[model samples]
Target: MLLPPCLPQQCGKDFRNSLKQPSPNYPYGYKTKKPRIVPAFTIQSMQKNTIVQPPPKCNIYEPQPARPTMFRKSYKRGEFPVTIEFTLSGKRLSWKVPIEKLDFHHYLPMFFDGLAEGNYPYSFIVEEGINDLVKKGSYKVLACVPQIVIPIKRALETKRPAVICHALKCIQMIVTGCDKVGEALVPYYRQILPTLNLFKDRNRNIGAGIDHTSSRGENVADLIEDTLQILERYGGPDAFINIKYMIPTYESCVLN
Candidate 1:
């Protein structure tokens, strides 16, 4: 008997021989066999081959440069050095100070306070810087004197004699250094004269042996004398007459 082509040769021979001697259950040809079960290893092998792979990882960390601050940009405006020259103790002195280093606007109040308190070293440096600026005849420096005069006058009213004296010294330096600056201060004379009057009778020797001979010294008499000289120079010869009229008796005695 011929077997079907779909079956294996050996299996076909066995099936053909069984067909010839059919059992009562399969009388016509042959009974249908049950389906074969697949192995677990075959299913695992198919799953492994069908899996999708992941893509390559990217680099997350990389260094970056730092950004500059606001102050760093503002500082660029004051980068230039300003060379200032003035006389201190009858000797010529000069300093090339960076514009940023001279924070005058912020420290001017403290400077006045220190001057009034007989802080000579600090006062001298400040006064000399002003004198140097004036001597340079800088329009920018001269323009600022008008605004500064009133504060200096206010400083004259401090209860501390040393402070009053130093304020006077600063005024003297301002007036003596430039005519325009002196003229600018003329209007404040009324406010200044009264303060100077308080120190007229003060004859104490405050700075005696300091090597520096400056109006910033603690010597009360020198301060009064220098202030009077500055007033006369800028306020004209009749400047004392104004002071005299303000306080007749005291001015008369001082003048005499």
Candidate 2:
């Protein structure tokens, strides 16, 4: 808009000075404005923009149950505890042993005592115990043979034909059951042979009333025959020759 002229020269100078000075809207130096206050994000506003993710699924592999290797079936026979099973010469045999009547440790000693005391019924019990051990395996039979052999050999030396025959039968079972056992008894053949001669002609029912027979289905005499055969088989042909040579020496040792 048009304005009036300055009245004086000083007034015109003052007006030029004012025009040179910066206006309030357009200041010479840049003046920073106070910072604008921005309100913080609330939980509801954040939830609207948030990206929800589901948990990862795991793939766990579980194994199946294992099968048993031994005794598949339970003992169905009477109230027989401790079913004994073992393999011999590729044949597997199982027997149910009554624990009350047959204790393995005292079996051989008690058998010998039965013979010593002339208790025929007790001898049958002992025979049953031996049969139980035989059914267990050759290993069990062989383990007890060393202990059994001593008493059985002593029994052979006795005057009673029954005791001698019973002892021979027991020896026969042990020796024939396993080849290893037969080989073990080979050294004792010389000692056994001389005793066997005493019983050669003595024919009597040594195992009377003993219903439990040998595993080979033989009586005492037959058992002695089988045992001698076993010893001959394992002792080799040289064993017979050795026995011939051993006889004179054994005779001399006895005579002296």
Instruction: Please tell me which predicted candidate would have the highest TM-score against the true structure.
Output: 1
Positional deviation of residue 204's Cα in model 1 after best superposition, in angstroms: 4.5
Please write out the lDDT profile of model 1 over residues 41-64, one tens digit for every residue.
455435533433334455222112
- lDDT tens digits by residue: candidate 2, 164-251: 5566656666666655666666666666667665444334465656545544343454555555655656655445555445443222
lDDT of 1 at 108: 38
The most accurate candidate by lDDT is 1
Q: Which ten residues in a row have the lowest lDDT in candidate 2?
A: 68-77
Q: Write down the RMSD of candidate 1 (Cα, Å).
A: 31.6
